[model samples]
Target: MNKPLIAGLLTLALAGCASSQPDQPFSLTVAHINDTHSHFDPSDVQLTLNNKTVYTRVGGHPRLLSYANQLHQQAAQTEQPFLLLHAGDAWQGSGYFKLNEGAMNVDLLNQLPLDAMVLGNHEFDLNNQRLSDFIDGVTFPIVAANLDVSQDSDLQAVENLTPYVLYAFKGDKKKRVNSVEDAGKYPVVAIMGLVLEDMANIAPNIGQAQFKQELVSAQQTVDTLTEQGVKHIIALTHLGLDKDQQLAEQVNGIDVIVGGHSHSLLGDFSQLGWEKNAPYAQQFTNPDGLGISCVVQAGKFAQAMGELTVNFTLDGQVTDCKGTNTLLVDKVFYNDVRRADKHRLTDTEQERITGFLAKQPNVALVDEDPGLRTYIDETYRPELLQTYGAVIGHVPSSLQHVRVPVANQGSQVAPLVAASQLYWANTPEVRGVSGREVDFALVAAGAVRNNIEAGELKAGHVGLDILPFVNAVSLVSLTGREVAGLLLETINGAIGDDTHAGQFPYVSGLRYTFNETRRGHGYLANIEYLHQGEWQRIIPDARYQVVLTGYHASGNDGWHTLFEAQQAETDRIDLAYVQDELTAFLVSRLSKNEQGAIEVHYQKQALDCQLPGVSCNADAQAFIDYVQARRPILTALPESGVTVNRLH
Candidate 1:
């Protein structure tokens, strides 16, 4: 054979071998968002640098949509096979959900071209009927393989809900095939859904719906999909990041996982201008040591969109993957202003320019997407603005609602919430018995979502941020020893190593010193409580009634002792809705005078000190009075009472 002929034949032979290989690589792109929490309107978010609040105003739904659309368009231009997924929690958090019963969220979310979304715990917040209605309204599939909805007729009838879905992607149609039989070659992608197994414990509206263990459900799904000749499989999970990571390691065939629930922001930290964490596409070796699975989660509140480009072998194994959890910056306005400046500038344009210039001295001005801006203004802004303007009360100074143990003390907001709960628990109308008082009140740090900013506090702010959950305030009786044990357990389980724990105890009439360096039960020291107007060390056997949210009283968040104590009718007293109770408490304080002019008296007392200066009254009046008198200054409890001996 001639040299040219030999070379051509060799090339043809190599191509034929490559086509026959099962390990051939194919690429697919996944764009996802999670835990939006009904925050449709753009709100001010404090941007932090090195754990310091650098500036505010970072995200909005409009900008998020614009960024997602841009990514979709780019994928289309590149002719890349892509899928858009929402990992869940599309309900609750904002006033929009409360106003429209998640109708607005469903409507707005329907506008996005999503392939699928896993059911989040919050989806059950409105009960099965509404959840079924919301599911019916959506155009895309709502998948959750582990949810046993047979008991719920409405949920069982949801036509769009499924266990898993398969998406087929045909290879390049333009590529010439020598044989007609070989023309339809392509890869099939299968995605399975798993919800948090503890849904019923967190969202009671789930009722009889049961959730299977994530590992079991995921493994079974993967096995089924694999047996059906599907090589590439993904778990569209609503399990938080920690569970997702565990799932990745435990499951055999899960090629990738898009997760939510923990509201984790995964990816290159430096690019997002936030704390460092796992890369957007975090890889984990399968338990069998045969393959690798990747996991990604977009942060909550439309703050970022996770973009993952994954390549898989023909046999359905992940070969390569890359991408990031892209932050949706409000840079679109810069161009808008530039374009407007070239023409006759309108009043809005002038105002935008002025605001942009003002941020220039310390922070950079990033513009939001005009399309999202218009949507918020025309569709969502009217009611939201009214709520924002409806002033509930005035705060003399900013009450800092930091979640971390600032100076070894818990959040100021937590105590305020606890005090409110305690006040309601003592009221005959709320307590149901005349002249009854809870011995102490406890509020979880996570329950208090946002801080009361120094200024006019509005009803909308409270509804949208402060008291977002609809949990009822409940009272439970426990022995002083049990109470002390519950506190110790909370610190050990939830507040491990002195890191920020949402379950961290914030009390109205309890004081305890926490040793950060100590392990297990030893973390707590010098536990004390106010009894009969005196600071007294807790008597181990003394029975004391405690006021807290029903969620907490049920022994959720590692409080099994409290749960055991709340089983008795005499021990447990369920009060009114927590939001309504808190609102009534604030209203009561505000109505002290015709002008609603009331002073909040929050004494700067140490966490370990005996009810210092009589300011440890543990009532709404104390918080109200403190706010009325302390103008402009952020309230910090005196550090003397609760001291931290170890390095944080």
Candidate 2:
């Protein structure tokens, strides 16, 4: 949407204004949210005191809307222009996204007065056709400067999709500020969008849609905007916070960046009892040393809304930047006390506590908008419950699926998940079709989002928590050397010195000992494979069949060796979803006459020690054996299945 009249008028003002003239201050509020991940209903956020869980219920979309609307109204009253920006990924995650394929998210988003939105990588999860349809229905502009959709006619035709859009911020009317007549009064803001450069690897179904590097594309867009006399430029980015920072440091002519992905929390985290970062509006010096750019991101899942107030000079350089990342709390949250400590709060005491919280100044608590609440409760909640409420299976004990390293124990759910994938891949039906057996299976730690809680597991749990994305399992061939190298790289690069990493590989039909204290590839040693009932050291030249999700198969997470492997055969098994496959494997272990209880336990095996103050071993063997046995009866989990060693 280019405006020739506005461009011409702005150019004339720029030419006439003297360089020696005093810099005039122009202020505007940028209210932004990112990576909502479809938590339409109020989800529980644990409130902890001194590392102990105290309260649970906290954020949701309704509360986000209320807080954002309040900010908008305040800006209007003060005669200050404000822009509401959403930095993508409004699709996937919750039951609502699964039920409506992002329609519900779009509906709710339509209700909000959004200025612009960017395309997140997850937006392509539904494939090109559905994405086009979703784009067609949107009211505001969906801009992405780096996306190259030239080969896809359908995507090119989507009306709402664009590379960039210009926003003209006329001075506040209440302040008696004139519009076009006062040439230098208003500022023209150019907002450009940039998605992650690795969209092709992230979502393969986004056919022919390529992405340019964020730094290059952002600079090009900024240069063009500046050439057009647009001084105020904001990069609406789906690039994660780290990349956004890099962009700010490298790119010139950009005044601000609103970002998503990586789900980073960037603000005063202490108010929420969380770790803090560099304020809500963090400024980065430009590489050219000309000016600084402000970068901000609202935490994911609508938990917090970011408010950035930027004051720019008449020449478009940022004079001052300040704002808050307010955590949204509901009124009920005020009354939520520790369950064990409830006896300490008498009726009168509870009332006084609630009153005290209600009266606290600067504590943001916004009541859910009635219309939005009704829309969710009456229209969407019932459908979500009906579809995802069916019982799928049962968990005998709480599965500890958190991603962390214990002093001497590894991941809890990762090994089990990898074993499940291997079990399904080796079935007669699957093996016969490909005429090849799976030597091992691998899963990225990030694939498992939430732990399977103890008690009755529902279909919704499988859909939303277990396998949130529609990733398929695929079979690929790699040499034993490549496999070993993959593991080494994973531990060295993914895990490294970090206590927990999403790229950590969980495997089946294979075992290895990793010395955390050792440097580089030497950290991994004593690699072995179970071949024909015997554990033998892997031969560097031997080729082995492997099963993994399409995400890893494409070399997304530093697994380029697998991606470069010989294409001997590729099969996309038409089994149920990954979660369903996991359910099937668990269900098959139950006998008709017996109740089902999937047991899980951890054990450790000593192989060898290499580095100082560290032992090397394989702990996944018990988990591998448990799945391989397919026991019809399991009253309780084994005492020791896999032991993890946490490196300090």
For candidate 2, write residues 449-485 as lDDT tens digits. 7555433445566546665654545566677788877
Task: Please state every model's RMSD to the true fold in angstroms.
Answer: 12.2, 11.9
Q: Would you estimate the TM-scores of all the predictions?
A: 0.68, 0.68
Worst 10 residues of 2 by lDDT: 583-592
Tens-digit lDDT track for model 1 on 1-648? 000111343335334443222346778899898998887765443333333232233455766666666766687678676788999999987767877888887778876777789999889888888998898998778889998888877887778888887765533112222222232244557778999887766675986688988889888988887766667788999889999999989888888899999888875455224467776788999999989999999888876778898987666678887887766544322221112334334567546544643443212234556765777688877987775555545443345565546556556677667765665566656445423578778777777776564334555666456766556455566788888788777766654553336766777677777776644334666777777878788889988878887567667665666655543323354433232222222101101246633222112311221322222122333233333334223344443233334444
Q: What is the lDDT of residue 116 in candidate 2?
A: 86
Q: What is the lDDT of residue 258 in candidate 1?
A: 96
lDDT of 2 at 629: 57
